[model samples]
Target: MFVARSIAADHKDLIHDVSYDFHGRRMATCSSDQSIKVWDKGDNGEWNCTASWKTHSGSVWRVTWAHPEFGQVLASCSFDRTAIVWEEIVGESNDKQRGQSHWIKRTTLVDSRTSVTDVKFAPKHMGLMLTTCSADGVVRIYEAPDVMNLSQWSLQHEISSKLSCSCISWNPSSSRAHAPMIAVGSDDSNVTYGGKVQIYEYNEVTRKYAKAETLMTVTDAVHDIAFAPNLGRSFHVLAIATKDVRIFKLVPLRKDSSSSAPTKFEVQVLAQFDSHNSQVWRVSWNITSTILASSGDDGCVRLWKANYMDNWKCTGILKGDGSPVYGSSGQPGALSGVLGSAAAQSALNGATGR
Candidate 1:
């Protein structure tokens, strides 16, 4: 059954994003109040606030954690037209006395002229890299030349989409047969612009990223995009949040080994859903990429799963802190507990003062 668990996020304004660490034991939340808070899960399964501080002068849009291999590091982008990297430091005597953690700003990226909407850390297999997309229709990739020196980052590549970008996801495939790739989504309102999703692949010969494919069927403004965790699969799965939730399957087409051209994909739309009745704000997949979760303006999180025949269906519908609105008879429903839910009941309560 679906259940309600009060997180008491304690942000002064609406929370925009919530991100769990690689281990799923730690989390960070960013809010419109221009602050970010880190939470640590206790042995009793309760999340305790370990650090809270102002992260930007403007509303923070997204916050993400780096691979645990890089230590405790976080990256955040905001409406302030900049992105900042933060590192957690413990045992400062005063902090140690209180048994608290402290996060310091390691670097700030100010390349975008418009608000930075999304920030993400690349897959661990890609080394220590960061990507940021802004409303100015630009995507920038940065790398820390030295893992030990967190204060310095070099802007490696910049790609212009010619459409306002709202979100991005890096293909997590670690197989040698696949190349490093990224998908960028746009929130541009002009319907005249054909498609909103673009896929780019790293060209080893050219030593740069090249446009491989454009999802022409996705004509709507995309709010969030995520690539399913690759588990030795030859094809890739992508979930996009827009007016509706959509799933796309990208099968890599075979190419000549001597070809320097980017690999092409046989793109197919697996599923499209409008059960939310409004814009879907976020989409996330389980670690295994079997179950998908989407939240929207209708105030419900719907879980999707595929059957043995690869037919995708909604297995459950859960409201914010309430009894079961609906559920599948045998489907594993509770959603990894409450740690991954970003749109907590606080938003519903805050709007009506209930």
Candidate 2:
């Protein structure tokens, strides 16, 4: 029942997003401070910072690791109005002339003019496609790293009618089970008081995109959305963050004998809960899909569990480990002492086999 002490409180500004690689051996975090930090889990079960790099001129909003085969690749976006791909290069040959140990850079792909709020690599086809949402109210799809040049990539298409997409999530089995479906939600606006949520389908036959004909709109601005990660055993479900967190089962469109074409599938709201006082900012589910974690502007992290009825009920809240507070809120300070204390504590615990 204890919260793991793995992440460090290193960001000066608020952390917007965090992601773990497929193997769960490495993790990355992006913050409003305009930087991305990488952490590696050691054999002793401690999370240690392996590298930190400035990836944007403005606040970096989100970061996601590529999955499937290209495990080490990362995609990040920022308020500076750009999205970049970062991959950890192994050898000294790939490093800059400065002889840096690890090298990272901007991938030449779908760069945006307005702030890029979120970017995610499709889980099934890691190197094939990446999807991004921005303040410009667009959801654009771009090809992943090009095999030939590696540096050059192109934007294949864009969806331009969204109203400031707050977040997006792609179905993991979209390539095989489903057909590359993405659910996106917008910020609350006066026109749509309930907010807007749209599910898009990628047509392999025509190589075009279309909105799911029937059951894909919501009444509230989506704060954050996530497709269930563990796909095979269970039905495809999407968890969304808003005034109240909602979980929906996405039933794929089935063609009836009378109707030649597939109909818009129906969505069943599984559970609803109002857990945060302020706007909920992020939602993450583990591979089990039984446990859910959410964070918001209230500066608290809460954990929830799914019941037999598919209802999400709060399980517990994670409290800080009472590590020493370092600096005054008004003054800038170094994070060395705080980091050292945490690392030493972890090392000591590991040594004692606690």
Enumerate residue pairs that collide in model 1: none
Q: Candidate 2: where are CA atoms >4 Å away?
A: 6-9, 93-101, 174-177, 213-217, 233-235, 256-263, 320-354
RMSD of 2: 8.8
Q: Tens digit of lDDT per residue, candidate 2, span 157-265?
A: 7887457776788877733556677878776464445437777777666566677732234675566788876547335777776666677776665654343233376
Model 2: colliding residue pairs = 194-219, 194-220
Candidate 2 TM-score versus the reference: 0.80
lDDT of each: 0.84, 0.64
Q: Estimate the Cα RMSD of every predicted model relative to the unseen true structure.
A: 3.6, 8.8
Q: Candidate 1 versus the native: TM-score?
A: 0.92
lDDT of 2 at 256: 45
Task: Give the CA lDDT, 0 to 100, for residue 238 in model 2.
Answer: 77
